[model samples]
Target: MNPKNPYKIALVLLSLFLFGCKDSASIPSEEDLNAREQTPQEESNQRTTGPIDYGYGPGLLPLGDEKISNEPKIGFIYSCDTQLNGGGAFKAGEWINESEGYWDPNKKIMVDGDISWANAQFTLETKGTTREIKGNGLPINHNTGTYPISTQDEAYLYDRNPNSIKEQKVVLSLPVQPTLAATPRCASGMVAIALNGIAIFNGLDAGGKDAVAHEIQDQCDGHPQKDGQYHYHNLSNCLEDTPRDTEHSALVGYALDGFGLYGKKGENGKILTNADLDECHGHTHEIKWEGSLKNMYHYHATEEYPYTIGCFKGNINSENLSQPENNEKPSMGPPPTQP
Candidate 1:
């Protein structure tokens, strides 16, 4: 009756087969893409060998991504936001939940620019032309206990820090390899930056008091100032670092002169003291830096005063280092010209 309709039947079967195979060749699924095409160092644990979050927020940056090219070789990856939780609210909006703000020594709370301005944020960048190590000076972390001077009285050596934590774009053209300065000298403030993006001031409080001794610090060993900029005046455990066992010292941060700063311990399970270091609280050795393979000159934090760095071991970046003491309040410039 239907004669030889076998040819039509065969064509329909072929079409079905092609349709079934079409989905197989379709664009790869997300799972497949993730398996096949993630960054080389994308799968590392931050605590072990990558960028770490100092309780700021969540993001990923591979510290050992060899494909990343640069001039100022970064020892570690940094968050674009400097790991700051931002000026306002704990998570979102403009400080709706003020309860989450850090507690002052008096158990009071401080908010961004509320009593004063907010903290600044830093994002590291490479100046393509000059090979300068560029960073946005951010006031991300600070202890509210002894800060804001709160009183607009010149008697306390301040009315208020005229400067808020505005992003101060700081740059330093460092030597690829650091060398000894002819005569090392101590500066007014900010000899370095901790890995968490906080500035490291010298071990001095207002009125030239020993910061680590007399100044009120938070549980993390830091405090803020009139500018609302949070910083460390001594060796603070707030820096994110792998806990050294009984015998291994860990690198904490870098000095402005291009050397590394280490913790208060040595490799031999010995508590390093100021005696172990030079005038700058540093010594030359075969340090196991994240990127360096050879021995180099680096500073170490002692249990005593000037816990981090004492002075400049290498040529200091004059543009980056300032006479913070001279201004003691760099923010205190002339008042606005009122109409």
Candidate 2:
């Protein structure tokens, strides 16, 4: 080979060796980004340490030693729409599937200008029958319920109006008249209200009998009752109202622990929203909630979640507390109306 050609080849080989030996920088790792994307637990801890002390709030002062109903029953008032299943079969959609639709803090389900009915079906379901116990005269029949009351008849008691809702109505019919005396009251000012926790634990159900109740937090322990039911505070104001807006957020009643209680049931559902994102940690974990796990009879508002005492009421928590003979009657109202 010629000397010049050999010299060029040797130079090219030297260049290639240099490039291969030199070190290259690596890309930034996920750990670095995670430091910026804070998790909900971290956020919760931060909120806890902040100025807002969520521990202390207005709670229903328990009156006296009461007992829960021996034969507790439950009822459900829901809206339905004709929908299609995967196999071309038509089915009725229940309100529980309308999670975002009903979780609205501003609206109320009213009927007959007295109480707003979230939907016409809610009026028919709850107007007559006790969700917890059956055969109380109020006709809560699923196949053929008779609730003629309508939004034309009732109105939302509380909306933007501050003073609209006062002591509201709650109809509960238990088997033994004596067992019906218990009414739910808030303990330590904290009602069974929750937003993030429920969003995370939504669709979780009890696996079997005596299984530990699944929830985001153990705040249920703070509740006045030993049953460990979680409920929201009731006020005369909207469920979204804070103590600053209203003097006291009355305790509503406990949120039931069941798959059907909240969340849209589906297979391979996408976790898109913030609530869905938080729930990813529990992926593939089945709903522990079964129909027979426990019998919880409670109530809330129809239009929106009841925030005030007069807007919604329940006899569940009170089942363990003693109510005066005169107050034993179900707290019924003229029907909810919107101002």
Candidate 3:
């Protein structure tokens, strides 16, 4: 109250300074604010170390009476005019974000309290002319989005995935040198196994719709089925290391017919479009095969519909293909409603 009272003024100023400091402490720092904005799945993805185990017990189910031959006849050849609900095909400009209202790469639900596989395993062995691929069906190299979309996650509003990822007994006896079949066959069921030890399914969803365009997937572009088998409907960019501008995309997986599946880039580092590939979503060209550059038939992933394989270009052993048990059948009646 007294302007000339220096001691009182000093006391008041010190109190104000201490109050300001307390208020500032209550206000979060920039780094703390940034961390608060990130979701649990986002935080899990930042990990650079090996897979994390969040105490989800180790229990794997057996592949039951599901047979590849039992799957309904829903296979088809790829075409540019392939009609997809929500949108015809994925273009480079379109991306998964909050505004899209369908899919978001940044937003992911958790699966069994895990964002990545905790017990990943895979191995490829060659003996004489046959190559044996074995694994517990889990992604060995990268991470996955959560499953059974948590009610709190924004992604849950779009896709309420009710399945949790689980390990499976997977064994495939493929050929070291696969030969083209006399006639291309429609691919169905578990069509391929990625290098990371995950399954690669065909493009169709349970309703015969374009799975890539309709269904919501994790940041790694994967989701689990009812059987808890985590698989990919399209190419996940995390599958391979970034290819140099001069390098061709690396082999990411192997189709049921023993043909190699490559990434987006083709010859001369060109991002391939539908026009660049055949009806089977593949082309014959010289590529590094078994340590030597040789001309071979192989499939390629694109941004469009039928993103991976369109049809089987090589001989496939149905016995070697492990089908999903109690696989959801495509609706024979009217088209089901979309989310």
Q: What is the lDDT of residue 177 in candidate 1?
A: 62
Measured on C-alpha atoms, candidate 1 has an lDDT of 0.42
Model 3: ten consecutive residues of lowest lDDT: 1-10
**What is the C-alpha local distance difference test score of each model?**
0.42, 0.18, 0.56
TM-score for each of the candidates: 0.52, 0.17, 0.65
Off by over 4 Å in 1: 1-120, 125-136, 139-167, 323-339
How high is the lDDT of residue 144 in model 3?
Answer: 68
Better of 1 and 2 by TM-score: 1
TM-score of 1: 0.52
User: Which candidate gets the maximum lDDT versus the true structure?
Assistant: 3
Error of 1 at 318 (Å): 2.0
User: Alpha-carbon error at 266 in model 3, in Å?
Assistant: 0.9
Better of 2 and 3 by TM-score: 3
User: What does candidate 3's lDDT look like per residue over 1-339, in tens digits?
Assistant: 000100011221122111110022122122331222111221222312112221222211111111122212212333222232222112211223323223322222322233655567777767788878788888765566676656555444445566778888889998879999887776665778887678988777654455655465665667777778888877764454222544567677889889888877777767676678886888898877765667889988865556678778899888765566324322223222546
- lDDT (10s digit) by residue, model 2, range 1-339: 000000011221122111100113121122331122211110011101112212222211111011111222121111011110111001111211132222211121222221321211111112223323111111111111112222232121211111121121222222211112233222111222222111111111121100011111111111111122222222111112111221211112223211111221112322111122111111122222111222332222221111111111233334422211100111133334336
RMSD of each: 21.4, 27.4, 19.6
TM-score attained by model 3? 0.65
Best candidate per TM-score, number?
3
* Per-residue C-alpha lDDT of model 1 across residues 176-232, encoded as one tens digit per residue: 466677866544457777643567776654434334443434334555554545667
Q: Residue 334 lDDT in model 1?
A: 35
lDDT over C-alpha atoms for residue 332 of model 2: 32
